[model samples]
Each structure stands twice: as structure tokens, then as C-alpha cells.
Target: MEFAFDEADAAFRRDLVDFLDRELADGWERSEFGLGSAVHTDFSRKFVRTLAGRGWLTPHWPERYGGGGQGAWQHFVLGEEMWKRGEPRGPQYMNVNWVGPSLIKYGTEEQKRTLLPPIARGEVFWCQGFSEPEAGTDLAALRTRAVRDGDGYLLNGQKIWTSYADGADHCFLLARTGTVADGRRGISVFLLPLDTPGVEVRPIDGFVGDHSFNEVFLKDVWVPRSRLLGEENKGWDIVRRTLAYERVGAPRYARAALVLDGLADWSRTRGLLHDPGVQEQFGEARALCEAARLLVYRVIDERAKDKEPSPRANQARAAMVQAERAVGDLALDVMGSEALAEGSRGDAQFRNSLGAGIAAGSYEVQLNLITRLILKLPKE
Candidate 1:
């Protein structure tokens, strides 16, 4: 169980870091106009294309799918660097992380031929349409329906808190195809094009930033059978695997760790590092970040070995949420008023930490999973 990176992986990280230093020389910031804002997405579209050109966008995918055919550790390295630098890839992270892989696993050949290339080229944006007004953490409760209509299905429902919907070209949607009594069995996954008729995207103002959330309305939106991912009424398995991939997708601890370093530097510059209280805060936050990083690495190791995603993914995601929250708290405690400035590192970290607890399944949900699956505790 060697934890250190081999020379090849370490060299890849060095090259990636150098490239990012040059690319983000202007100090890339996600807080400038929010992630889904025109300004941010426009930058992401261009930046990701550049990454694609470097064969860095989907390096872990098979080469036939337009990836570099690299190992999973290499892909994880890319994620850590991107997240630390504020994830310039924006919404495309979903495409590379799970969306494309899900398609590769379950999509028809035509579906793969049509969709995989665009994602590999970084020419598209995608959003998840899983969360509904009635189904946030309880995704099986989603009521969005897709009824059989000739060769396609007519979809009607609403999805809320859809991140980056304003910039996405397509949606990885979930809808109920079976009767309401079926619960999770009733659900189906759809690769829906946003331009389809009767689909509307409405922006929602959110504390994170403008356009960070949206309401996606589907009123008799027609999707061809070709767009259905895997088998209808059997999407729960796909969702489970997709969620596993998503749990450690963002590498939030990398950014949190980077934020901790910044705070330490800030403290040192202001002679605040001498204070025992501030010192303890920084040390604790740093420890949390390291612990979270190692937990995530455990999950990635499973992935590298092609193991089924386990409860460790849930534990890793929960640890990342804690690490982010710890660093966010340290920022405000040590930097005080300076942490409150709009678009500042502290402000951005605080907002990201809030989202981290909720995204990729909430922290509480992860604990429930840990209890049931890892600890093998009976359900309460």
C-alpha cells in the first residue's frame, strides 16, 4: 500500500502544474460572475478546449473514446490540479467524470458514436436533472414522468437546483417511467438535448451566485428511444454507480488544502501566526485536509483497480465536506473582515463549503450510508 506517487505520475503532475501556472497567470476566479454565468461559462468553454487539445480532458478514458488511455491516478491528478485552481473546466467536469463513462458502459453504439466525441473534444456542457422540488436527497422520490409515445417518450416534470443549466447543451435527466408505486424501480435516465421543444430553463437567484441554480421545465418534451440510457425502469443501478463516481469527483479537499495554505501565509504576513489560537486553528484545518485527501485517495485506489465503488466513496465525500468547512471557518476566524470581501478567497471558500455539504449527496446522507454499509448497522 504505497502512498507516494511513482515518478511518471509525479512528472505528469509537475507538467500539469506548470501548464496551469501559465494558463491561469491572470488569477482565475469562479466568484467573479458565478459558475453558470455567461462570463464564467464562456471562459470554461475556451479553457476546456485548450485542455482537450493537450489530451488532458479525459485522459483516463480509452483512446478510442478520444482520451489519452492513461491510468485513473493520472485522471485524479488532473482533477486535483483543476479543483485547486478553481475548476476552470466548469460544467464539463460532469461530462468527463461520470456522464461519458456512464454512456460508454450502457449507451448504444450510435449513442456512443454521437455523444462521446463531443465530450472528448470538450465542445459541450452538461447538467444533471436529478434533483426535483420534492426530491433533493431522496432522489427515488422524483416524480418527473416519461410516458411512452410512439417511438419516443413524452417527458413532463420540473427539476430544481440544476447547477450550470444556463450553459449546458444537454441534461443527464431522470424521470419516472413506471407507476408511482414502483419508487426507485420507476425511474429512468435520459440524455436529453436542451433544445428539444417544450423544455424551458429558468434562472434562480441563489446565495452561491447568480445563475448558480435553475428550474428546468419539461412539458411534453419528446425524447427519442435512442436517448434512453441503459434499460428503462432499471436506472437505479446506473444512478448508484454514477453517484459513486460523483462522490469524489470534485476533489474539494485539494482546494480546501490550498485555501489552508493561503490562510497560513496570510497569518504569517500579518504576524497572526504567533497566536496560539490561530496556530491551533490552522493545524486542525490542515489535518482535516490531509485526512480528507487520504480518504479520497483510498476511493481512487479502488477505482484504479477497477473495483466496484464501495461505501468508502461515501466516507471520502463526507470527509471532503468536513475539510472544506474547516478551512472556510479558519478563513473568517483568522482573516476577520478581509474574509467577507466579495470574490475573495475566503468568501469563495465559504460558499464552496456550503455547496460541498449538499452536493454529490449531502453529508448526512453519507453518514447514513457509512452506518448501513460500512459499519453494517441495522437501519433505524
Candidate 2:
């Protein structure tokens, strides 16, 4: 297949690169804190609004929703550039990538009117309430409940590993609206306002860093029936499809490749590029990054063609995790003791690589999907 970008896409990339260079010429170092950091989030709020002003924040969404009506490839191109520059858009990436689109597809007309504009304007932050203390990975087993109460639901439960919850305005939350034995069939999605009464967000200190993860608790939080997304007891289908887009949403391999370039520059400056083992490792890491990029592009190509979401997305996500880990390892090998320094490129890469495998879905879970779907293997 041809890999060359047409003139318009090439021009778009050039313009986007120029825009990033101009906007991030100073103080962009704050983004190195990684997504969900107070530093990163603060910078992103302003940066995303700037992008929205330029009509680039949600370019793929329809024009009626305040977007530019661009295609998926344009959005993917934007993501690649942002991720390569360490994703200065912060949590707003989710707002454009899957959250707003999911709302467009499943939200009520009134909900769409109320919510989509803020996201398109880059005026809000949203956190996903997916993982629970006991229900991570195996999401269908989640126990967070939303009981019927008059015309609304009373939500009560806890969600862990919730990124960006500390400063979020709303949550794309999932809860069990039916019995536990109903598995995936029991779940529903809620567009929960974080400031609602009885809602609490507690920061969790972890390896990824402070403000990156939190535990969100709900105690008799009242949510109007109008807040429910899609249909009750039918959220699993929406989650599945949303995860498909999300799997390749971040263009993580783009960041991995950029990190690899930095590692190479570091090696060359230290005259370590001449080492045979170091050279070999560099070659392998570069190969993995390129492989991951191509795999992701394949998934994006399918989306551009409007093909059904395929197991190829799972394969692409798995490759991205491997690519990130490989580059992270290479940084440690090249940087030696300096790699341990906080905020160092190697140190940041290592932290990001650790989260890459676990976020969205675990690497092991992606392998299970590839085996069962791509390889057509029977379950044990």
C-alpha cells in the first residue's frame, strides 16, 4: 500500500509542527511532568483553549458540534504531533478522542447540546470512572451501583485509578444498574458531575506521580435519569466500541519514537553509539517503534474506510506497549545513573512506559484478545 501523504495532509503536518513550535517555545518543560500532573494540567487548560480557538481541538467532529468536520486521519495526525511533543493537550485528549464522539453517538439531544460545546471549546476536563478496586481488567465484574430513585439514580461506590479526577469537571462513569450476576449486561454509563453532593475525589500517590490517579467515591449521589448515557444494562456494547477507538487513540508510538531519538542523541554525544551492544539495542528499539506506528496506522486506515472495528486494534495497542517498554529500557541503558534523576528524559520515559501497559487496558489483556480474536484460538 502507498504510504505517501497527499499534499493537503503534508501541508497540515507542516502547519501543525510550526504551531507547536511557536506555542511551546518556552516553558514547555512543564509538560514533562506527564499527563494528569497539576503542572501539565494547568498548562493544558490554556493550551487546549488555544487549539480550540484555531479549530483544531475536535477537528474530526461534525461542524454542528463546533468542529472543523475533518476526517479521522486528520485527528490521528494531530494526536501524533501532540504525543510526540509529550502530549501538551493533557486530559483534553480524551475529550476529543473518544468522550465527545461517544456522547455524539449515545447521548440524548439535550445532553449533547449541554456537553459537547464545552469539550469542543476546550473549556472543561473529564475523567473516566472505569476501573474499580476489585473490578479492573475484568471490567464486567464491577460492583459500583446506581439504584433507581424516583426519576433518577442514587449512585454509591468507589472507582480507583481514575486519572485527572482531582481537577475534573465531569466523569464518564460506569456503574452497575442491575444485578451482579448480569456481568457486562448489568452496567450503565453516567455523565456524572464531580461536584455533585456526596461525591469525593481523593488523590492517590503512586509510581506514576501525584495527581495522576485518584479514588472517586459516591455516597448516595443523585444523578438524574437524563444523565444516563446510551441505555441502561446495555453500556457494555458502547464501552467495547469506545475502547476500540481508545486503544489506538493516543498514538503512543509517536512519543516512543521521539524518546528513542533523544536517547540516540544522548548516546552519540557520549560516544557510546560506537558500542556494538548499544547500537544493536538502538536498532531493535527503532524497529519496534516503527512497527508499532505502522500497526496503529493500519487501524486508523480501517477507521477511515469505515470498516468494523477489528482485533487489529488490540494487536496495535499491544505493539505500542512493547514499543514504549523497549524505548524506556534503551534510555536506561544509555543514560546509566543519570536515568534515575527525576524529570530526566529517561526517568520520565520509564514512568510513562510503566503506565502504558496498564492504562486503557493491561498488556496481558490485549494479548488475550489477540489470541482469541486474531489467532482464532479457543479459550481454555
Q: Which parts of model 1 are misplaced by more than 4 Å?
A: none
lDDT of each: 0.90, 0.90
Q: Which parts of model 2 are misplaced by more than 4 Å?
A: 26-32, 208-210
* Candidate 2 vs. true structure, TM-score: 0.97
Candidate 2: deviation at residue 129, Å?
0.6
lDDT (Cα, tens digit) per residue for candidate 1, span 15-129: 9999999888465754674455677678889999999999999999999988899999999999999898888888899999999999989888999999999999999989999
TM for candidate 1 is 0.97
CA lDDT for candidate 2: 0.90
Give the per-residue lDDT digits (tens) of candidate 2, residues 1-380: 67977777778999999999998856354235577677778889999999999999999999998899988889999999999888899999888888998998899999999999999999999989999999999999999999999999999999999988988999999999989999999999999999999999999887556458899999999999999999999999889878998899888899889888878898899899999999999999999999999999999899889887889999999999999999999888889999978778888888888888988789999999999999999999
- Steric collisions counted per model: 0, 0
Q: Any residue pairs clashing in model 1, and if so which?
A: none
Worst 10 contiguous positions by lDDT, candidate 1: 25-34
